[model samples]
Target chain A: MKSLSLKRLLVTSALLLWSLTSLASSQFTGPSRDANGNVVPTPKGEQCVEPTADMRANHMKYLLHKRDLTMYDGIRTKQHSIVACIDCHATPNEDGKIVRIHDDSNQHFCASCHAVASVKLDCFECHADRPVEAFSDADYDPVQQLDEALAHSDKPHALMNRKVQ
Target chain B: MSHLDQETDMKNTAKSSAPNKIDQYRRRFLGGSVAAVAGVAIAPGVFLQTVNAKPADQEVTANNRWGLLIDTTKCASGCSDCVSACNKEHGLREIHGPETDAQWIRKVTLKNKSTGHTINLPMMCQHCEKPPCVDVCPTGASFRRVDGIVLVDKHICIGCRYCMMACPYKARSFIHETLTDQLPHAPRGKGTVESCTLCVHKVDRGDGNTACAEACSHGAILFGDLNDRSSEISRRLATTGGRELRAELGLNLGVRYQGL
Candidate 1:
């Protein structure tokens, strides 16, 4: 009788768990849509694309205005980099870091994108080809800079014990 | 009643079964797991961000100095109140073309290729404790205010833009094409490199806070002395999950980025 009771309890618990999980799963997943409507894990890999008509429209507008066309009306510089703005902005290279905001190469930002679509982005005329110019930090201490530099250098020269050969 | 009496009559019917070692072990394991789960669920909520339960105006100390806590999770999309506020206060929209001269603060959106996630970040000067603009300045004119605001002394600015090269945020802008570009909205003089001052000119009169912070509809922008724990900026930094940009640089900037 005890063995029978144990088997009944296990079966009941298992059924309860399975039912609860199925209920939760069904509740979370809303109606699934078409191939182009949402992201699909393609055989090539999990491909990411701007999915909807609205999204494509939005990205297209951004692309038009923010296109990294270096030599536009307000370019303050005589020289421009042939490298496309899309080169650095859309994807991070091997270093796995975003283009530092100061990098002139980072033409892929939405603001930059918007500026391209809009007329006369004033800042870029001064900035597009040059380095990022911004405000100076106020709190640097000369004392700490040297200390940090030494500490940052290769492991205190590994405490080299020199033998006068 | 039958079941109650059966329990009470344990003295007569209590069959002393052999010690069910495996069952006992199973029961102990279940009990232990229940306790462990209870600890996990409750411990984090109570411990995390709880110290920030004090009034918004509580005072902060060193390491506690002024900083912003931009909650990325809470930031909403397609909102531009912060931009409008900046332009309105700085008088950019009135003349309104792209030449709306004062772009001290602006917003940018980025797509994380690995995740296909779209994140919007409101960009501003980091106001490094040890600012690169100050470090590279040959004239020593780009000085830091004791209160942690960085500024260009109009009297001394040469517009060389060396400080701009040193800044990582691309926050600086030179008044180029001022003859053609200065919008009737806010006419800026040529030859001065300018970026967000955090509204220092207005903050001096004690009239307005940073225009951007006041205008942010979503509270993405915050301003205050990190030294004062009670300051809005300080309190937010303490309890919020804000991480500084290039924190490894140890520049210790005054500004903080939110919702990346």
Candidate 2:
């Protein structure tokens, strides 16, 4: 009887330990890896302009303020500019192609976290998702270039034609 | 003392202070000339290098009133290079017919019925001093910048098209279809009113000229500060003169036309 009770205690503790370990590990699992278990591309910058925690909390505030300054006041300083953010964060993949922010794969830096957080990103609907260098040629016609890019993309028309709400 | 002696003494005192006053005036004149000469010598180099570029950190102020002088004689009747350049620069595409498509600038040919004389001109947003669009906008989306450039704040524009009805030039266009892959400098989304920004991005970049102005092969367009007396546009307007379209409306348009 004593042996059986000791065995039951050990089993209970083992189960509890296993469950606690699983929960802790899941907490650490970030959006760094995609559903296919591929490592997501990181930002090109060595470090963000602000500390990571601070940026995560107050990036929208900075963007909103800077946008107003740039739009109305014509203050085009690079600090906290959306163009600077896209140039650093939206990096090319192994295939040497940068993904659009609204891509369903959710591999793009902004989209990955946004997808997980269930936040709808409307900025990319009007703004360029990639740097100018990502385009094939400097003087290429934008309409033709976009058409060719869409043709090569897997979900061509559907992605480009998605209505903005 | 005798009266004559007293008067002479007073004259002597006046004579004594006269040279000192002259010397003070001379010093002031010399200092002013030196500063003026320095400004003249150094200004051209700085102006030529960075033509009308405001500092990136500084806010655009009312000190600079940007204006454009278009020579109608230089603009060809069939030529649409300016329009094409504007479209390319702003990433404007023709997804629909002329009725629905966005056009920032269009060529209008005017003919005198009695004289049989014809004139070709490129017409765009006048960028009025007191913009009717700004006044009629219920959402405060249509606004004029401090530097005299009129712009539609797309974020606040609710696609009401009130500005379109208010504008005398028919300058504003409302986007009806969904758009993607817009240029970084120019952000256009559906359900927003947009018009000729006068290349505000380039203006902000200190490029000194709009894409349309740069692409004009005949040099019909002269863009410069209307406030600056020495600017080519202002000097030419002062000498040769330019007329505002619909002058009776009294909008005081930034864009002026010559040979119309």
Error of 1 at A154 (Å): 66
- Report the C-alpha lDDT of model 1 over B1-260, residue by residue, as the tens digit: 23234334432432222233344346556765875586588876442222322222221112123344555555567776676666555443222233434467666777899999987767777777788888887776575654466666533568898988998887776665443222211234568777776665344334336776776777766666666556777667767646778889888878765555
Candidate 2 TM-score, true structure as reference: 0.76
- lDDT string, candidate 2, A25-63, tens digits: 545676345433443566888999876644654466568
- For candidate 2, write residues B98-216 as lDDT tens digits: 67778898888999999999998888999999999999999888999878999998878899999999999999998999987688889899999999999999998888888889989
Best by lDDT: 2
Chain B TM-score, all predictions listed: 0.65, 0.80
Error of 1 at B78 (Å): 2.2
Candidate 1 residues A1-165, lDDT tens each?
Answer: 889767645544454454355345545555221211221111111332333322222333323332221111111111112113222233332353333323443333423323323323343332322111211121122223334545777764321321111
Stretches > 4 Å off in candidate 2: A1-31, A34-39, A137-165, B1-51
